[model samples]
Target: MSPEAGTGSPIGGTLPRPRSPATRDLGMRASLLFPDREVAERYYLPLIYTACRTCYSELEPQEIFDRATSGRVTTDKQQDLIRRVIESGHGSTIEHIVFTFAISGVTRTLSHQLVRHRAGVAFDQQSQRYLDYKRPSYMVPGTIADAPVEVRERYLAEMDESLAFYGEMLEAGIPGEDARFVMPNATRTNLIMTANLRSLIHMSGLRLCTMAQWEIRRLFQLIRHEIFTVSPFLGSFLAPKCVPLGYCDEDRNRDEHCPIRPHKDNVLAAWAEKRAAAKAKGREVPTL
Candidate 1:
């Protein structure tokens, strides 16, 4: 649980709409393949609400789940409790639910970063070692695509040459495990990732930020959309870290150029001013 969660403040109050990049058709996709909308609507909330309710209720877990799922507890009440428990930094309550995504056509560069998250998450990626490529496609970043004609042409030609050589190596009886050494980071791959709610929110906080790599940020954007389609309430929790922190912490944003939130320095400066004013009035305020 984040320190900000202990404040019991709703971080999703006004999440800036994620930027819609022009990379939509670039062969990338994130589909929530499990826990479809019906399941999410019927079981997900009840499960989380039951977990939260179990903490302070005398009712048995089974009875609580039954009441929640049977509509004995109204949806609004369940959501309200969930919102409060989550905002109260009781993260384990929400870990009972999980989401699985079928992610495809992202670059190796992005997949490398994606798999680094190890807690409360599981992933099985397409194996480059077992599969042989036939007309394998690669990604051309917006920067490279929009470069001068000669630079763009050279980039494409280099990619084509690399794949052509990979094919020749395979035909010459090189194992894919050995031949994939030539595959550029731009080569596309697929993965199936399942993460509990807590881990999903944590990953989203890091990956959905403006300071994140553009391709991976776009991937999380697509993932956030998938979560939104199934349950907007759950999706609301997916946001950049600064949203929850109520200030930006990235050193790159020290200049406060991104504007999503004030820098931590500025927030602390304001806090100090308030504290000093209270002291001058012969009163003291609690320290952060």
Candidate 2:
């Protein structure tokens, strides 16, 4: 059975789509390559702390770094300063330290979205052009894989045939670059990504949102977990933007379908009502 014949849903519905359970392992992996918890705990906080302290202290930057790195400043004191600076929106302080991750087995679809984050992040992706794929593998969406037996088999067969044709093209003296055109978005790929803490948090905010694509959202979920394993304090900041903003700003989410955060429109409407009431009583409400 063709997938088109199976579902009557519109292509771009405003309502959130029902996501299949993420129980199936898509073989996605995101491993932190730098700064294990101890390193992060020892230097990351101090680095940011030094950056923050250098602003207020008359001392040189190196002196601040030395004091923060050495036992001159206590951990509690360093963390307190770092936390205050971060909360006050001094993002550059956090940018002094970076985290690297070795990500593998993600589909090209996810990689394309991941690379859209251009600020403070660097990516080194596995080159499809340089290496001939002797055994190409691809990801299957959970929804497609959990379809009716016939539908599932059809999907699998199509992927198999595409790869087989790719192999046939290679045998016929076709260049790998040209043969790779047949590869679908599901084609698995690997990448090495490096991003500062600030950028990581920013990326997490968007990708962790309920409105994000299911696969990419899952990827961020894995990333957040990895960060949490190393530093829960830093990991605590890796949440949906709405989680921090206290309101959902997404246009499609105006219907309040996703309950993670209240719709911004509703919040504004409620505030307007309160202001109207206050105005009627001849009292001006002070705007924040």
Candidate 3:
């Protein structure tokens, strides 16, 4: 693993970091399709602030929104309130706003995992049943790409043969849907995904984790970059689950292979030690 693979930590601890792969071209792209900088800057925050403020304010939502968007409520104050609300786990407040993306050339492997996020997100993928693929493209994992000549060649040959046979089946009058059965998980696909801010945060939490599959992690990185271009404040929330939780929770992280954060088990053990010391001093320690 590269020594500089993970982001700098605000928390006080060191752990193993995995070597994150570079996405670089890789025949895939994810572009933010809605809320350009102007819209994001002018409305997205205010929209979310309104949602948060509505819970406590006696004023009508429109009045709150007008106050927020028209600058009567300073952006700093709105952001402070919104940030606090979000950190407090008021998820429904953030769900009032959404982001849409134009995703293309990702593998069926990735699309399968992505569409699994059902709540507060919608996905429309290219249909093999409807669109007849002419020259299908596919992904080669770095392992395969860097394999020995004979191994790499065999992998490519098998993929090429599978795609070619699918084409032949199409020519022989097999339905595209049936022929698509021959397509490998590596076959590239496209999708349009729209997700509410809460869902996006939740999805990013999982997909940005080192434990996540590399392709999906890279996809979220691209998605995060796109969000940063428009709104860095909101973009900051799209991070590994451990980032928000303050400790890694994945059972696999017990060995500390991907040291983005201290594992939850370790954190709890330390907390218990502190509690025991406090008890020894005849003091009460708060429970987590």
Cα RMSD (Å) per model? 9.4, 5.3, 7.0
For residues 224-286, what per-residue lDDT tens digits would candidate 2 score against the true structure? 888888888788889998987889999999999889989999999998999999999999788
TM-score each candidate. 0.91, 0.89, 0.91
Model 1: per-residue lDDT, tens digit, 1-288?
A: 000101122232232333444333566889999889999999999999999999999999999999999999999999999999987889999889999999988889999999999999999999999999876778876555545667666877888888888999999999999998988898888999999999999999999988998889988899899999999999999999899878999999999988999999999899889889999999957765
Candidate 3 residue spans exceeding 4 A from truth: 1-18, 285-288
Selected candidate, larger lDDT, 1 vs 3: 3
Please estimate how well model 1 matches the true structure, expressed as its whole-model Cα lDDT: 0.85
Q: TM-score of model 1 relative to the true fold?
A: 0.91
Per-residue error for 270 in candidate 1, Å, reads: 0.8
- Cα displacement (angstroms), candidate 2, residue 45, comes to 0.5
Off by over 4 Å in 1: 1-24, 285-288
